[model samples]
Target: MNYTLLNSIIVIYVGLIAYLGYLGYKHTNSTKDYLVAGGEINPFIMALSYGAAFISTSAIIGFGGAAGAFGMGLLWLTFFTIFVGIFIAFVFFGKRTRQMGQNLEATTFPDLLGKRYDSNLIRAFSSLIIFVFMPLYAGAVLIGAARFLETGLGISYITALIVFTAIITVYVTTGGLKGVMYADAFQGSIMFLGMAFLIIYTYVQLGGFTNAHVLLTDMVHLVPAKLQAIGHQGWTSMPKFGSALWWVVISTLVLGVGIGTLAQPQLAVKFMTVKSNKSLNRATLIGGIFIFSMTGVAFVVGALSNAYFFKNFGKTALEMVGGNFDKVIPLFIKTCMPEWFAYIFMLTLIAAAISTLSSLFHVMGASIGKDLYESMITKDNRGSQKQSMFLIRTGIVAGILLSLLLGYILPISIIARATAMFFGIAAATFLPMFMLGIYWKGVTRIGAISGMFTGALSSIFWLVFIHKKEAVALGISQAIFGKPFLIETFPWMVVDPIIVALPLSLAVTIAVSFFTGNTAIQPPHLKKCFEGIG
Candidate 1:
């Protein structure tokens, strides 16, 4: 690959994003505009932005690497992403969210929940959770992109991390959500098109799909002895029932990310950006198609790359990629694709990173500044648009700095797991409250708070104390209370924290709400906001 050409293309792409950020700044006038793009974003841009924010470098790099390690079985995640994350999200959640958001005059996720229930505690606590946990998600995304750069371009990880973070922060702080959305739309298009091409090119390079599968099957007997001994088959074939890999893929990766998308603060907030339910309906088709292509292609290409590497090097692609899992896709791209295509792929990867990072930072900023700060510290200063915008920008900077620091400190091997952990936590904590709050008027403040706290705390406790990595990191024995944390008979994969926590949260929410008295007092502006929108 021509380093000069690759570097030049990246520079041009980033410069263009910077220019777009400047344009977004010009359009940003009030806190509403900064936080929600004036709630007038085009449906196409809104859909693309939603997809871009949802499918980060984590999806392409982190999960794609996961596909390499786990095989095509992880493709179930793509199906769920389209059906659950996109279709259900838009059809079930989007319209109600838009109506409720407008009705409550809410700009951030926390704002919607707090104002919906008329609880300052909800606003402050929700903001606190987002500010604290979102950085871990953001850090994982940073590691995904930086790991690609280190593997693909031979750049230092720290340097790549700094550069990528700096570029995204500059745009996000200046351009706000509208800027982030516009950039995301553009970057998302590149991601979709680039992945489509990469998939096709990979198949062709491997002497077509049939031959590739045949080759992979023939090499089944060559499966690592250790893996085979552990009940692993070939990469082309699915894992055996009760296998460790099988459980991890199905439970943690697929279910974790697939179900988790509904509660993502970054994606959920996007539903509030559109003008109407009709816009959200329209976006559903666009988002579904885009996600299907981007995620589907990544998984297909990742699986097929194994065949290609084995043909050339007499070893699986994972062997050449240094077994880091995160490096698999980058290694595949560098070795298989032409220099020009690799350059474009690099741009696509960067676009994925920056687009998602911008959205994450923007949401984190809004949660901290608009939702928490204005509601708590500056409630009386709501009329001061300039002051609120300044605070939001300051929050963006703080979020970027915190995430960067976390990215620097977190171990690279577990980057993908960390990313999955964030999503799992978000789903467990926010999904029930968000969904029930929109549709069920009986949802009390105590119910919401209990659900949020239980879901969030339980998810974290499982990931930290009960998870295998945490056990190893903390030097604790895996056998606790006879077998793991909660239940002995149930598999760890079956009883993942998200599975446990989400239901528990919902149960607690209903139980507490029924027992406690209602604190419901609809906001004065509710009817005015909901009157015209159907």
Candidate 2:
């Protein structure tokens, strides 16, 4: 609403980010510095940076918008992230990953996994997956930020998309992970504080916490006939089980992201940035609080935006935004909240977006440069810095352009759905291989490769042929099978790709590993990976 104030804030924030980027550029000497922050970072900064990168605009704008449109059942996602994403990740995965990475002298996630499996093809396959799908995830975040900017600043969506991407292009290219972490710490703080205010103020506006839910519950009769047919319940209650709506919420939204977080390359890579086990333990406490303030608040507020909109303007959130779920949170903030809070919230969104985009692009660059180009293309597995830097920046620029393009063409209310799809894809492609590669010596190169391919191929096959939401949009099944999806049944059509593909990946990996256990790697190498850590 206030361009002059907003523009001023933008300048200051960009100036700080630039300075941090320069600091990172100055500190980044070796490839290790650029990729993993020289293997030492503050626990607080690492935790906050990890949380900030993990949340993104997808959590706030996209998922929050979903909450507003659908209801509060998404709260289960918050619980999952805390338990699985934060706790299981740190206690079970993070400690081992850090030591294994240090032992392998790995620079990126693909490098870590590939070295553990003693297979360059494993690295190439994993890196290819990241390079392919990470941009799509980044695109979802890209569009989420642009949507908010277009709505809050009253600009066209295309203009918002370009301007935001343009700002990110200059700095992320120069700044290494150290700079990214510093900027993330700063941005994550704003997000946490802004969201803290957001939840409190929203509740205060809608008759406190208890009354807010009551207001929403009382309006359950207002559900449209179309929604009720598919199990639309009140905001306070979960959808009726076995319904399409129930499957989407649980299978796609909650489980897809919640489980997928464990195997995310961007998040996994951060664990290696910390030097010791204690740092990760400290990080767990800070990370849990940060995640709650971001996703938990966004979902609760998004669900309750319905109550707010109805009481004030006699329309549901979907009605107010003309059925565009992505615009719900932005529209609500601009219309309902105080002008000053809008400024903070906008900064919060910008921070969340940039914090995430920078990391995603950086990870893309590393995935391509270190994992694919160096390991696969070069015989020595590492070429000159000039060549390496060239490809890394090339990956960054390419990913940025692709994400910007997706931001333009993606359909309305596609943010959260797109995010879940990316997460699920990541889960299917890498989760089984990655998890077993670290934890089990019984895992073989053949098993890891088989699992990765099976999971990735099967997941894509299911998404294109069976998953109702993505299949109908892609329409490949329509042309070949003469149907939008190959399956027209009840729950089978609605079940997530991760549910089926992940289990297949696990079973295939284990079955193959059992047969190939005698062909395992040298004991000394295996000992190196498991040394001095659980």
Candidate 3:
């Protein structure tokens, strides 16, 4: 097993992370520094950090497993991740977000929105949403890494989850955003190298790309009966367009996380970490390469793993991993890749999980303590940076525990579902107001509030009542109404909430703003927010 080599790699990685945390701690003199790295981080660090945080174990393990079962249809998500998530995010949203954050002196995403609209309620509500729902996403990230540890190293899931969370919480709570970003940059580099090797090695192992694709395509007859019934065509092609598989892949996986990336609090806050628009522009290529390598490799390897498994073991990747999609990639690496590469790839997964977890914890803590507590719970503490920072750190610990608990409670193969849920809900809730508030000056405070609340609630309602995953998992609909899901119509069960909720949110914002008609005055700070970045 080369225990010494594995141990040494892990130890060195941990040491490097600790050193970054120390650097963050040494530099974090004020609350602003703790929150946004004093808004002075270099472009390279911000780009790598953002990309790393955006593609976590959820992408590598969760969505990778999804590709295993669903085939290359998940590649659409990779395209969205690069074009919308990285390209548009950095070029369009990043410039305005940084301008607004610096102009408004906003430390958090909620702070930016709240201050721009001059509404504490908006700030508090946004924070509450983040605190409440982000754990689901965080839990997905935790479970992905935990599965890797459990499968690759023979560690118990519970122990892996706890150890992973503890390490991340320590650095994030102490070093704050600085530590999170620095660690993320380092982790992102490891991910880039690991994934590049993974894709190349996978192809070499399964013959060339053309040969592998042909083999996978020809193996369509080998797909499980259940998957075939659900419209799976083959490993190298998209599913049947109108099938249930297509609906889940397109509505939930593709549109959900793809569009949802725009409103992500953790990623959005990264825009505020640096000072100039040029920094964001410079980051685009770096971010594009990082995302493409990470997501592109994950989907390719995941789909191809099936062909590998079938060739060697007469089974698909999902069958080999016992139908738990989240376990597919971990099992693949452990059973297939060389010993040294397997160990290195395990560390890559760790880096992916920890980087994302650190950002989620930091954002959640800031939302709770900085926005919720200071702004709403105790307005008198608004000026107390030390007290607020303490509270935020406390919130970080609490968020970690909550996510760990969720990781334990959730069912298997729930990682991608949970990830989509969080992303969809976040997009539904915040995307309208966030994009409108930045681009459209006509967005009123009332409209923003109403839109966010309406969108957020509708997303929840859809998840509980219509979305089959939560409908079946939670059993609320069944308990109350004697059915697994409240909706009994075609495509309703398969349709994602984002398709409905996001439009409703956008409509409400536009309708409410038009009706209000100059009644709501823009804040003075907003004008500064719109000013071109110096």
Q: Write the per-residue lDDT of candidate 3 for residues 353-393, one digit (tens) a residue.
A: 98999999999999997888766655653657788799898
Stretches of candidate 2 off by over 4 Å are 378-382, 519-524
lDDT of 3: 0.91
lDDT of 1 by residue, 1-534 (tens): 587897788789878888778888889888788888999999999999999888888888888887776678778899999999999999988898888888777889888878877778878888888899899889989998898888787889999999888877767888888888888999999898898889888888878879877887787776667667655677777777777666677667888889989888888889989998889988999999999988888877777777888888888866877677788888888889888988898889888888888888888888887778766765555757777788887888899999999889987556667777888888888888888877776777788888888898888777655665554454434545443334334366344577678888889888887777454664454444345443
TM-score of each: 0.93, 0.98, 0.98
- Each prediction's Cα lDDT score? 0.81, 0.89, 0.91
TM-score of 3: 0.98
Top-lDDT structure, candidate number: 3
Tens-place lDDT digits, model 2, residues 24-78: 8889897788889988999999999999999999999999999886789999999
**Candidate 1, position 141, lDDT:** 90
Q: On a 0 to 100 scale, what is the lDDT of residue 338 in model 3?
A: 96
Worst 10 contiguous positions by lDDT, candidate 2 = 374-383
